[model samples]
Target: MIARWTSTILAAACLLAAPVLAADLRPGTAGEGNFRVNVAASGGPSELPDRIGPVSRIKDIATLLTARDNQLIGYGLVIGLQGSGDGLRNSPFTEQSIRAMLQNLGIAMEGGQARAKNVAAVIVTANLPPFVQSGARIDVSVSSLGDASSLQGGTLVMTPLRAPDGEIYAVAQGPVFVSGFSVQGQAETLTKGVPTSGRIPSGAIVERQVDARFNDDTVLTMQLRNPDFSTTIRVTDTINAYTQSRFGKRTAAEQDSRTILINRPTEVSAARFVAELENLLVETDTPARVVVDERTGTIVIGQDVKISQVAVSHGQLTVRITEQPQIVQPAPFSDGVTAEEPSTTIDAQQAGGQVAMLEGPDLQTLVSGLNRIGVKPDGIIAILQGIKSAGALQAELVLQ
Candidate 1:
């Protein structure tokens, strides 16, 4: 009984506090209800500064323009799968690969005939990143190239991973690690994720090194992940300022929106210069955008977004249907058929249909005005679209 009384008091307090909060709102504000817009703009909401983000390291924004990962691919076979493996008759490649393996082991087989329900042909692939030395272990992904139901609980045979130049750079062979599984029964089937694909973590041993010329070039290039003219200029200016303070001259210049060339100073080692330059921070810029996810009813507003005076009114239409079935009985001693007749009554109601005038000189006021009308997410989407069509909403609307 005490808990019940406590809950009652809490509800009463909420009811009493609601009107007091609403009383603080502007005169034109509508009644508040279940809807709200919670946006954490990059700049403080009240300030609404022009800048969208703080300083970030050059290494976080750009990649070393010269260095990149190399793609490697190989063909091999997976074995030891419990009847889920490929059918030897259907997958000729599986038989061919098995026969080749046996022949290499000094067992000469004629016609390349090999029969095994536990073996499956697969493609092995891995990305050999720059600076990876010989004997380094890397992860390899194995994918079924046959009619195998699942690669779960299977062991991958020896496979040679080769770069595009047709040179074997790594050797991959290990027990496959399948994160998902599949089960098939006569009556039902259940599966999760993809069963025909799996990965072997750190299963490939690199046998060759791809040489990178970081020191050979007198100038090093930096490539931005996202190309922006303002960001490129800022990066150039920031690097120049830092270098001028240390070396008495500007060493970096913007080559384009995506590239920056840095002259290697003679006093510093190439690696040391790059390592130090990558850590310098520069403020980043972002375009004003409002992202809305229709499926999840999520809306994100940027800090620099603005709006002209606009009006929004959202009303909900409720539809109700009731069905009643009545039966007619035959009279005693009278031959008559009894039948059921369905009577349906539909009632529709339009409530809170009045338009609420919403006008704001700033983003905060605009959000508050929209929220005060108690509009649901879908209704808000329609209203926002209408506002944008009327040239009131200034930010770009992106639908996801």
Candidate 2:
């Protein structure tokens, strides 16, 4: 009887062990974490713009005759920060904004002593592009108004963005997308980029559309971004040539250096006229000028920039002084007191330089001449300024 009972017990144990063994043998039944495989897709070649003698479409070179983007501004609050927001106690405007927002939502708050360190008062700005219909999205920029440490991880509440005419144009409400972050600990703090400002892509919705006057006007104008008499003449000639070839009539005229007046033909509609003319290619004409950014030490020489015969020399003199203190001790037998003696070393040196003549029949020679001088950007800026002052640089020197 004992042996039979033992055999039955062993069989029952074996039946339970069989299922456990089978499950362990099956795939995806391991206790390890799941594995993921990522495949990268290949991309095709890219198209780059031709910088030299570049031909651009008429539409790319100039803005539409009357269509322009209007600026919209608003005030709002940004919440949800990691203690990097404005101090509510110090910023009464934030408390006021909060109170007004709460009242607008049918919530009544009696006291204005709300203390929230994770909320910041911000100024939101967005540009309403031309011909943007209702319910369209636009980007907005948010900037802190008070002493806020960071604007990361914040959500902008519903705020009405108004134009200069006091008309509400769009409504902005979205999570702030900050490319930077700020972190603080007991030992140190770390920050990158600008933490007090952020941008929200597609954050504003247009509620009203500004009426486009060009739609009903018989004549449309084209305003060049970089106005030049030569460019204006070229644009007008191109348009007139296209019209003469297609409609057998000249419909374009140059009004000024910046504006080209387009006379709409009776048969061709304004939409069709503009569509055809905007795609017409015209070689851009730029003035002979040198654009210099003083802050960044950047120099941009235009294609037509020319320099007369001029001599330029670059040299710098540096003087350095260092102080060293020495402790003087008296001998054991001599009656002298220990005292500190001061010694200073002065160094003066000047870098050697030779004057180089610049005679630019073209742009390449001018660049080579400047490079041959082996001067730093700051030195080059000074030399260029001196050349411009002496009337050696034929191009207009614009300082920025």
Winning model by lDDT: 2
Tell me the spans in candidate 1 whose CA falls farther than 4 Å from its real position: 1-52, 108-115, 293-299, 315-384
lDDT tens readout by residue for model 2, 1-400? 3233222211111011112222221122111223211111111111233335769899999866456677788778888887888887778787777776676566778964677888898888998887788989999999999898999899988777767655567778889988877888999999898889999999998887876544354566678999987777778778877888898866666667897666666687667778989999988878889989989999999877889998887888899999999999999999999999999999998884688898787899989999899988878898899999999999999999
Estimate every model's Cα lDDT from 0 to 1. 0.74, 0.75
Task: List where candidate 2 sits over 4 angstroms from the true fold.
Answer: 1-52, 329-339
What value of lDDT does candidate 1 attain over all alpha carbons? 0.74
Model 1, C-alpha of 315: deviation from truth (Å):
4.5
lDDT of candidate 2?
A: 0.75
User: Roughly what TM-score does model 1 have, to 2 decimal places?
Assistant: 0.73
lDDT for residue 203 in candidate 1, whole number 0-100: 91
Q: What is the C-alpha lDDT profile of model 1 across 179-260, one tens digit per residue? A: 8899989999999989999999999988877765555555677779978767877887777778888888677767677977
